[model samples]
Target: MAEVKSMFRDILSKQLPVEDITTMVLRKPKLLPLKSLTLEKLKKMHQAVQETTHQQEMVEKEQQQITH
Candidate 1:
């Protein structure tokens, strides 16, 4: 997670555009945080967050590669 955050920082430092990042990070359908979410629902939300974070890292990596 820290590595992904650092990669995102690196991408922004290199002036990669934010639109792509936002799309990659936010386009996924997030699980609703219901007060009564079952254990499975909680797990799905965690999975979604992990996947979203991974996608952001991938986008940042691609952008950095292009800039270099």
Candidate 2:
């Protein structure tokens, strides 16, 4: 758990490079198997991206209203 927390800190602090994100993920700890979980996570992440894009559009629209 400490390792996981340290990894998150590295990510949040940008101490880890962009390429290292892939490295960290692909080289995940042996305790948790992720061969199939990664794919499922990717799918869920795609959905989240879509939702965030929609929310961003709504916020932009509201900002336009506020300006005018």
Candidate 3:
């Protein structure tokens, strides 16, 4: 009985953790940016050019209508 009890205690002690404590720090998540800075700037420039061209075309159409 003594040998069995000791063996059981040993097994239990091995399986159980005593006074094990740890703190976890959760870091704030940042955006995983897909676009490069240069690419974003280029996209903006292209959009501006497209808008300017569209506006110019609308103005030309208006002038042509006024003349005709």
- Compare the candidates by TM-score and give the number of the best one: 3
lDDT of 2: 0.87
For each candidate, what is the lDDT? Answer: 0.87, 0.87, 0.91
Better of 2 and 3 by lDDT: 3
Which parts of model 1 have CA positions greater than 4 angstroms off?
A: 1-37
Please give the distance, in angstroms, between residue 5's alpha carbon in candidate 1 and its true position after superposition.
81
Candidate 3 runs further than 4 Å off: 1-30
lDDT of 2 by residue, 1-68 (tens): 99999999888887766776676434655676556887999999999999999999999999999999
Error (Å) of candidate 3 at residue 35 is: 0.7
Q: For candidate 3, write residues 4-26 as lDDT tens digits.
A: 99999999889746545355678
lDDT of 3: 0.91
Each prediction's RMSD to truth: 32.8, 24.1, 8.0
| Top candidate by lDDT | 3
User: Which whole-number lDDT from 0 to 100 does residue 67 have in model 2?
Assistant: 100
